[model samples]
Target: MSFKRVFKQFSGSTLPRFFGSDKEVDEFSQKYQYDPKEKLGEGQFAKVYKAYGKDDGLEYAVKVVDKRSLSNLDREGLKLEIQVLEEVDHPNIVKLHETFEMKGKIILVLELVKGGELFDRIVAKESYSERDAASVIQKVAAALKYCHERKIVHRDLKPENLLLVSETDDTSVKLADFGFAAFCHDELDDGCGTLVYVAPEILRGRKYRTSPDMWSLGVITYILLCGYPPFFDTDQEALSKKIIKGKYKFRQEDWQNISEDAKDFIRGLLKRDPEARMTAEDVLEHPWISNLAAVPDLPLSTMQKELREFLAKERMRKALGAVIAINRLRNTLNAFAFNDVDGDDDGDDDGEEGEEVREEDI
Candidate 1:
């Protein structure tokens, strides 16, 4: 029922480090001019909190990692995430505002993604229209392409890791959570990444060049369009087996109505060999996405059925925020149907994303 039982044998491998990296920022880091205002979420060693910047109106999600957890060697992983995040200036990737060592802990001041995780939206709708799904896929593909070109690999790519700023439909996909990520130039000694999203070669402990993220993107695209993942295991061992074999059938109800190009795209991404699978550039250029208008769009419901989506998400976010705040949150999320990530607001080719992450290689 957990990641432990599923990859227990691999536990002696590098898998454990992936999940263990979320260190509590409170341990050694202290916010200057910013105090934790709201607790957003908690991981094994870290807690994401909303903080207000001193002298600035901007709000940031401060990721606090306990210094005690980061051994001399582990500091490199933390450094890897920070350095890579700052260096990768892509619209789809989350923006890193600032990172500094406070006391002994490391504090990562990042963009406060208000809309939360994409999984919430996916689970709420139970499925997505192809057009909408394609848009999300395209944005992610672009980001992955940027990362791949730089020899960076986002080992973890899943709905939960995909943080959002607005939920305005097809416009809100921002790739977030780079904690388990690693560089392509570095040794692939660590089989680090989420279990469900890990590509087959990664699980088998084989050397892979790239395309693991594409496999994850494929899984995300399929789930967005079909309401559930292609694989599931009440037990981790079974899940691993399912992952290695792709042991599931596409139902007539899901696949019949969906486009064949989309299916082919997913199949290409799900290739077992990392070398054989479609690249991020190839995915972005795929007919399913590039030729989106060519495909027949699904019909929209005009009745009370149309209202169901709003009602469902409203119900879901109620417990998470105040009534008025939640309503505003809903509208803002809806606006993400067209949020600008490549906004050259400052006129520099390196946008607010590049500026926000000051310590990047760029």
Candidate 2:
């Protein structure tokens, strides 16, 4: 629920810092001018603003992270993201122009994507078709294939991370956000990623690789055709259990109008075994993706209805999760305070010893 919690769960060891060790803050400050009024968004660690290059007059999105606000782990994760972004170059993947450090803030200059999230465009459409979804998926697959070839795995691949180049360009879906991405030569054992989109192997705590990305793509594909995720539960643990078991159905009501070829493609990607799952290249070659024009345009009113309901429910779940996390934190703090008072009153030499005695007495 919390960004810090997500980072703690996913982040690995620190790599060499991406920026030059000897570069001074003033040097970067002199190279670019940021427009204070043109703000994009803010996260826990950083704020993104629209900026322009003084020399070339090119527009860019600059993410500014306050060094003082970040932990060592947070810094490591940010550096790793930058490292991954620097190596990747594809039309479907958001480009990183450059990175700089200035006055205790790490600034990442990224390509400015005008059009919003991929889901926003789909939701805005009056008549959605399998062919439309396939076209979008094709672009995403191309991006993934490029990354996989370079040994980079985007651990987080959901609709939210997929963005369009422009409102009119339905085919130009660019994959954004590399915070949870990793480069691996062998299987990785880290349990990380968003809950519903995560692969079965990762949920089971088994070693996994780029195959999980394909699994996430399948989930996205499922949602593209329908409105909701394949695996859904109000409870996180229950949802995780479903994912680990790979227990999901097409629900006759939802799939009755959808094409069989689309379903087969999804099944191939969502296979329980990573080895059995389709690779990015394989997905690009799948009939549904390779020949989108042939896919039927079945009415998706039912899917649209379900998606609206799912979005509402997802918002509620996130709100509930935040409240629960806050309450748990408050309770722990209260208990710690109570223990501190009891320990002080008991005339104990060691605070931990008195706390243990109080806990046992309770």
Candidate 3:
């Protein structure tokens, strides 16, 4: 099926109440002059379209979000994202041009990044080296330093969130998505972020700060130099346990070609103690990142092939998880509707039971 059709069906199935009136949607379309033919991507809460401004004819990625589909926590997360995006100003970060609200939906006008994901670009290359990996990490570190200095913690940092400006522009790695970001002062005791990228401290249910992001960067750097993540597990519980223990290695087969300085850099960032982890500024000053020219060019065909397979499996896993989540949401909504129709007052018990399920699953 076409991406547009698939997204339409997914949105309709997952969020029936979020669909605005035809008149409201028409007004929004007229205001932005968005071409429905130019779909960029779709996510759990929004659909992105490649739009052109009528005033200047400049291209933009317009994200349409359904407020009615969001829970109270989800709404708060959106607000936090907007706040962070508005405050951040860095060359390596995606820009948010403007935002508008109509009916029960919010529209965000974002910078259109022509280049695809960073890892996908690397995998497409015929040859990848430690120097090439250093260049990417340097840019990512700069972006993280910029955000960290501003007291913003990007709670979620993964390869998929890193994008290049264009295929030819290797240096222009832009950090995208602030959906899970929050202020440094915010209490972050809840377990959040992608499973593999989550830090040891977070996995242990400890109150975390910005160091978790550094740990995630370490994981990305590890994959960049090699093909696969340092830690891997099919089961979530087992993965969390592994992460908490900080059990990872630079296997002889992979590390034989990789430099000691590179391994040291990863070690500093992936330290089990958040206090011991290196900051973004420290990463920028690391010898491996500061001196990239001396790094060796190694044949990474094996790594590339492994990365491609890992990414394919990860995509399937996420798709399955999304389907499961949608089904649960549908069941919850149906139960609420039934209760309302039957004039039932057992909502308190149902809500408590739902909370228990979330605690166990999450």
Candidate 4:
């Protein structure tokens, strides 16, 4: 499915502008260099490529957004994302080095993280344990705590957005993707975020703040300890109903060997009431996270097995999506050709999504 976001900009906003004549950087080609390497990733309105600074020679990821393609609200969302990235600096969060405003596009230079996604990395591990899961959550929770202190809420928190710094270092997980993030200064009721990880209050159309993010974190934690998601169904409505009801269970097969502290941690995060859900600060102090020694090192073969199946399905889904994108592009081209032949008015229709986008890629 296509990812969508909406942002309503107001006067007297706190975000800093990346464009305008006052800014020093206006030309992207003069500051950095790239090989036009095969596209690292893509999104609805942008494409990502590997680039390096001209002076420092350090590697970076450059996200190029076509201004002509963005709607008014999309541009506002992009501006907010840039402002939030500029406001925060943490080891576990992806860093935005600088930005450039070209003639028809805006370019954002970001930290180049080569490590794969969180679940993909975990499935490859020879041995996994509660301690390992705790380590991953600890870093994510710490990063969230940093953002929440500034009143920023990351509306989307899923395994795809969590990435390791390098293939060899699994402990150094970084939180990527801020497309749905927003400042939680007032009550929000926008229906955004991926379906499975979405919080109950959002689906119920209730006003909320940062609590939804914690619920997503809880779902990720559950997936990390087990292989599959807590809530699942063939139908979207059915799955959403389960999430709204907070309907989930820790099967004995997945939890028989898992520690009680770990289970308790999940329970704390998955609470139905937003107020009852654990905050990022509370998560940092939980025994499962604070007391690492208490966590077990037992091999999580069940998780690994389930993860393999889950990953396989994910691959298939992506492949199908790519095929669909290609077919749509072909159809659009064919339509243009027909219009050109018939000379039936000037046809100007460009489908929104152009590339196969991944969470960390953007």
lDDT of 1 by residue, 1-362 (tens): 12223233442323233232223334223333454567888776677787877556677787888866766456556666776787777767888876655444556777777776775654455444568778778888888888888888888897777766676654467888887777787547356666556675565555665667888897777666665556554334445544655434555654677787977887778765466678988987899989878765673222113234433543465455423322232233333312332341121212111111111111
Candidate 4, residues 41-76, lDDT tens digits: the string is: 988899999998888889999898987788777777
lDDT of 2 by residue, 293-359 (tens): 7888665877777666666666676666632322232233333322322222221112111111001
lDDT of 3 at 171: 56
Which run of 10 residues does model 2 get worst, by summed lDDT?
Answer: 353-362
Per-model CA lDDT versus the true structure: 0.62, 0.74, 0.74, 0.76
| Candidate 4, residue 97: how far the Cα is off, in Å | 0.9
Clashes of 2: 0
Error of 2 at 169 (Å): 1.8
Query: What are the root-mean-square deviations of the candidates from the true structure over C-alphas?
Result: 16.3, 13.7, 12.6, 13.3
List, residue by residue over 1-362, the lDDT tens digit for candidate 3: 11122123432223233334566556556656787788899888899999987778788899989787898667666766887888888889999887665567878888999999988887787877788888889999999999998888897899999999987876579999999898877657655788788886665556776888999999999888777887776666555555555657676676687888988888888776677779999999999999888777666777787777778777888877732222232233333322322233221111111111111122
The number of residue pairs in model 1 that clash at the backbone is 13
Q: Which is the better candidate, 3 or 4, if ranked by lDDT?
A: 4
lDDT of 1 at 279: 91
Please identify model 1 stretches exceeding 4 Å from their true place.
Answer: 1-32, 125-127, 186-189, 299-362
Global Cα lDDT for candidate 3: 0.74
Report backbone clashes per prediction. Answer: 13, 0, 0, 0
| TM-scores for every predicted model | 0.71, 0.81, 0.80, 0.82
Report the Cα lDDT for candidate 2. 0.74
Best by lDDT: 4
